[model samples]
Target: MSNRMRIGALLGASMAFAFSMAAHAAAPAGGLGATHYNLSSLKSDGHYDRFIVTWRPGSAERANPSLMRQSMGAALSRAGLVRATLSAQGMMQAPVQASYGRRLAIGADVLRTSRKLDRNEAAALMAQIASDPAVLHVAPDVLRHAVRDIAAPASLRPSAFKPSDTEFRQYQWDLKAPSGRATAFGDRNYGGAHVNAAWDLADGKGIVIAVLDTGITTHVDVNTKLAGAGYDFITDAFLSGRKNDGRIPGGWDPGDWTTGRPWQSMCTDEFNPPQPSSWHGTHVASTVGAERTNNGIGLAGIAYRARVLPIRVLGHCGGYDSDISDAIIWAAGGHVDGVPDNTHPAQVINLSLGGYGQCTADDPMGQAIALANKRGAVVVVAAGNDNDNAKYFSPASCPGTVTVAATGITSRRAYYSNYGRTVDLAAPGGGIYAGDRSSGEQVSDGFVWQAINSGATKPVADDSNYAGYAGTSQATPHVSGTVALMQAARLARGLKPLTPAAVLDILQRTAATPKVAPDHRIGAGILDAYAAVNMAINSGGTTSQATLLGNGVALSDLSGAKGSRTVYRIDVPEGAGKLSLRTSGGSGDVTLYVNRGTPATAEDYHCRSAHAGTSESVVLDHPAAGSWFVTVVGRTGYRGVSLVGKYLASR
Candidate 1:
């Protein structure tokens, strides 16, 4: 039979059920009478049904191993038999209609049945089979299925922040301007200044960050920088090949026209089919790694050196978990049997999309993310746009993921942005621009620069080439770009492959701390590309050194003690080799302890000499994966003695 017909028949047979009330019937007279059991009760009660039967070994002639196997096979082929397996002396068989409460057996001189069973049906089934004359023993079959429940978060707010004309022009200029060349204009356009500085270092060669959202229309800015293109997930086909008459790519490509409309209602809209919404993904992609001042046609991205890998995941209300999970895994260089491999594997996965819901570290989506991390992909998530604090959202709440919140130009929390301790850091998400020093009507002070999704036929908004959008969505790419920048910096320095932890450390440690207190909403602080890249280059260590000093010696004890000191030493054999340290508080008064070819010191001696504060640890070089010993000795007995440390080694 054909595959489809075979599947249909299987489904039909599996669903068919017949109930009848019949008294126990006598077993058929034969060499060994066999009885069947029903296991429906076991299934409903979350149990397994099993049966066991034992048969005596007979003489060689009577045993006839081949004959016994033939008999078992024949019984298994019977109409109701579901499965059968042979053991040493007998065989066990299960029937499709077997119930947990019944048991039967067939043996040489015995035909027995157990009282209606209870609890473990699998155990009861085995017991019944054991009492049979022709059978050895029966047991429940092992089965497994992939089961997971993912809590989807609430929807993100629609992009509401728009840049002013002057601000827009400033950003455009920054994109076109060269690095280190001061513009005749003052720092009034510092936003563009930051982008230019980042691009100067990026040199535009890195991983392709995939933006899985709406379909991106072919605009000058986007087309000029296009590395390659693929289908928007909604279409289930390539967006570039839709309506082409074999010459020009053409078709009914639905863009982001349904932005303000409800997803459900848009189902019936002629222009908005169940296909990729245009602008959302495009805009997000542009913000992440748009092409910089090459031909100077559009805005610049934080990682001007990086490329984009647009993988549309959102359409209609929102994409499904299964699809998003697939996109995430695929984007991170994972292999999915049927789908084409993501040609350009993304080192940084930017999720500008999120929803409301509690997601634990163990959820399937979280598991998939963990898998991505194992493969060296850094995931950046938006801390939802709900403007709430207490609740956590999916993909963001996923463990080991970098969740970002939104901040305005003044370094204040954006009113529409979400907040919580879960937020790792914040970035310029735009603010309510109070129109020109006069009318205070709230307008959007564009803080985000990205590509706009124009419909395939025309630009959706007047400023289709480029526009400013503000949200935690926009903020997310800032962090993603920083991650890319750090990676590129590490590459340029010839450092080891950047791990997720190292990336997070660089971003958090060098981030620009806001000027205000209780800055909980904005997270660690605003993103600082210069500081982060500097950290990567400086932290890439090529030398190895160990020093021994008494307690209360600062890292200045090792160096001259003038500049910022980043060094660390450890005593655990596992933490020896190369070390880096960073000190806060006093003007560099930390000390290092090495065994120096002597026998190991006592734990208390090491702890006491180390000042034993919680912040101190001994880091090691990369290939120095094994254990090593060194100690961190604090300089002062004063109460607040804390220091941070790390190390890098040759792999």
Candidate 2:
């Protein structure tokens, strides 16, 4: 069975935690203005209650509107109910006094109050309502309470660094060295120039990336590096607080490891041994920000300077929507009650875990992600480990999120990675031959790296160390790290901080287009850390103009289908600036649009003509520093539009 179906079967019948009566017991002295109940038992507790009464479907008791109105009014008056209103679905939500025990039966259903019913009582009431012939499913009219968590000051590190011998081997010398140029190197050859370029900028400083997976262990790399103790939404304990040494705020707990065992559902025949510990979160963490050059160690991270804020949301049978939602909100820097404040909110959230499901705009998880973006956090999610495009998984499919697909070392999409238009970019997530795995592939060829839980004792195989595995999970961090590099470069240049949109722009614009034919699998192209950083640094804060044709033109001369449209290039300098188009001579309406590529769509930059007169101009503002194409088109059915474009200087 699918994970969702399994989880639904297991938890669908389970009740959400009840509010502590000691905490929420006190009703205002004046009483709750009007108590809404889904049950009939609560009416006797001196609290006014209201229940929904629906009409039976296809029940013909004479189709008289007057009769229906009179019947409802009589029932309300007899039940001592007040404020009765007819609903669009022919249902009524009326406030009735508890003393009136008269239960008026409509067809086979009765309307009553349930103010005395608690959480359990309400559930039973719903069950009863479901059984009623006149009712479909009765929803609790209880006041929906918002669960709040504490908010901390912004002092938490947004990124983290990994430490190990393998990492040291990867960064021992200048990453640019060609093969024999370096001495302390492993046979596993890799070009370091790109890695170094990435490190110089992002190292994840200032950007908050939340790891929504298994809780991180007290591994050496994590503890010494960017160890920002995150919350454990599952156990309701601060992970750092569980630390035995007390040096780190949260301590380690074995129960935190919730992988393996039968599915969370109660299926008796579905027995399967626990999968071996992957230490998935730790490995993912190292890739993004493993510490660099820490003497002798394991593989190096993509962004050595970045920090990590571990937010553990997945555990036993994956995680629940409620918990994941809370984690997303808190990780994005929103307040949650009970949990300590997230002092350092994440600027980027990395979600490597996803079940099989297609993406929808209205999905609850999608809504939560939208909230995260609104709070200024860029969410990056794996496309999925399954190699399919028809199914786009959650969190990744959510709007405003940067969905990442996986590419192999050769710049080809990985065989196991999902792909589609929803995918924003591709990154090098190591494949089979890239590292060592249990598949018996040669040491030099199989996936090999600093494996987490490599030396564990408890589960015996759960030790934290390095090992190489291949999946889109590994590829996501590469992009996350690049984003950090872009952000860091922007910060160094004294440029204003980037919004999520700006970051997306930089990533897409600077990406290296695939040398092979472009495919839907690889969106823009492979991630180019060096190019991205260069763009951010060299992008000056002004606008410059480009000439498409020689600086002379006549309206009638451009009349034919062969009439050439000049390609004016406008360069936006560093910082924010505006670009405008104007012409010395033109007849009909003129329109101007800006695009990054040929055949720009509505997503590109555009502005209407200022007027029909000569020297008329239209301006586009806040253009980022980059190469853009401005096209002038005749709008008034006129043969041609003549124009001169210039970059308006910014103050």
Candidate 3:
């Protein structure tokens, strides 16, 4: 999932993220006009032969349709381009009138030439309209593929039981690592995300996670109902790869296979190579809400019983930013023309896939994310497997997303996982690469193992059992699934649905601090599924205190004035292994101090305030075994900061 597949494919010259996960299977890097796309070569079989023209806002042409049509006619006549008005579907968006249809952006009209114009001629026509002084921009309405490369069957460990959970759980190291029965790898690894402890508190109930990917593929690991009423948003006839079908109402994966020659060179470079169907959407869907503890199926998901809503956006090659943007809006129950209303809106949306480039509040993707947030949806995105700073990728870098990075069995960053401030948390993305495959070490128990079928590859149940794939693509669901657990736990406690910021606050506040020394690269820390759900199920609208000795626990949402202070007491055993304290959430100068004295008059035995803005940590390297007070002093006003403390005792 790493190596050179980084930055899969760039969408022509447009700033788009259409790259794949395995090998690079996106539009070639740059130059769509020459090397990327040749209009004359298009088969027009599934490709549409029209262009969309959008006018700038406040343009008189939009309000006066007749004048706009006359101006367009004059431009077409001068350019000698015979054309008709039709949607990409060969029908008028609105017969005999300039209409308001947001299939494209608002105030955009589809222009069909008398005869099909190759992409080059389309570009020429766009240029002609641009000279009219009223046109905003013109585009070919290109097809997009989902962000998944070809599939090479995941390195699943050979297990003994029937292809059910009874056998699969033994290899699902992501949940019960070294504690469960030994894996085929023979190493009792103890580096999973530690989700079972949380599940005991509350298995996800009645939560909906919207998975926007290739769509769901049939598999026994998950309930078919898990695929919930989904819709395919791939509107481009050429990219749908379904002959001449338009957008449909079912969210299903239809093999996304691309050879070195992409879409007849619609967007290909010498660097792009051949890839098989990734079965990506299915892998992601099962990860978020797959059934567990029933019918003897595969491994359990982070959020069991959480309904899955599959919204198919990527197909043949990859999907467009426009399509994904619309999916976000529609998933949150926002309306999209020609597409029916979503009967069941999702509370949380997971995007295991990503494209090239970053998104800002003003960009199309950023705006869509903002809209989703307004509708009370939590958007979790992968921090791309590029190994670069995450701020350079779309959605991952976009605001409001709980950006996730990949971690290995050792709870360290995956070699290829992107990092930096954009990352919000880390999860098991599996990094067995530590072992030399040339040696006897099978990469078992290293990759995120789940149920994914490669029907586009071979015949039979060839690649469908249980498999593993590594990358932030695998880590994202861990966070998304855990989110479902938190939401369920919150509602069960009779609390209102959490806002996006509050959810992020809880996640970071309850996260397991990094095993290594503190660092800003992987965001707050590794996701502690047990910690998050435990707090959710217990954190009511009250300030409750508890007795925890030699146990790592979090005190969520503590806030007050600069002169105010909140104190927590901890009892360290004589031989406690370690002791630590940390603060997170809002932007405020907070100092964490530890002292074995009175709560109000305690002396500082340890103090930490590395960098401001909520996250503060203090460690007492081998402290005195006695009663101690953990105090948070607000150097500035505290607006909902969370404090966590841990005391590990060596048995």
* Candidate closest to the true structure, highest TM-score: 3
The parts of candidate 2 lying over 4 Å away from their true place are 1-193, 223-228, 235-273, 291-293, 434-448, 455-464, 515-520, 546-651
The model with the greater lDDT, 1 or 2, is: 2
TM-score of 3: 0.67
Task: Please provide, for model 3 over 1-651, each residue's C-alpha lDDT reduced to its tens digit, 9 standing for 90 to 100.
Answer: 011111122111112222322212222233123321222212212333454555667888756656566765665565555534565568643212122223443335555444545433454554566667776555444343333321223234333325565544565667653243455566455457778777776677878889988887776566557454889987766666776746888887766666533563664444344455667777777777764445566666778788888988876666766677788888988887878888878889998766444455544566678888998899998887666667656668788899998776666676667788888888877764543121244366667766666453321232345556767877888898888888888777776777776577557656665554333388767787887677565443322353333356676667876434566778777987678878889766566656674442112234444344678887777777877776665545677777777877868
Candidate 2 positional error at 629, Å: 9.3
**Each model's TM-score?**
0.56, 0.56, 0.67
Q: Per-residue lDDT tens digits of candidate 2, residues 105-168?
A: 1112223352333334333344443444433323222111101101111121112324445445
Candidate lDDT (C-alpha), each? 0.45, 0.47, 0.63
Question: Predictions ranked by lDDT, top down?
Answer: 3, 2, 1
lDDT of 1 at 122: 41
lDDT of 3 at 380: 94
Model 2: weakest 10-residue lDDT segment is 1-10
Q: Compared with the true structure, what per-residue lDDT tens digits does model 1 show for residues 1-651?
A: 000000000000001011100101111122012233222112322323223222445633124534443343343334223444442347453333332211111122111122222234343344344444555433222111100001111111123333333333543432322232333232222222244455556543656666655444554455324334433443222222234311111111244333343433533233223323335555566667663335445455667667767665554344434445556787788865345666677888887775433444333355567778888888988775555551334666678788887665545565556678777777666543431121233333433555554343234443344444556776777778778877787677666656776576556555554543433455556666666666666653422454432223454323222113322343333334565443444332333333323322221112212222224443334323332334433222223344444444334
lDDT of 1: 0.45
Query: Predicted candidate 1: what Cα RMSD to the true structure?
Result: 17.7
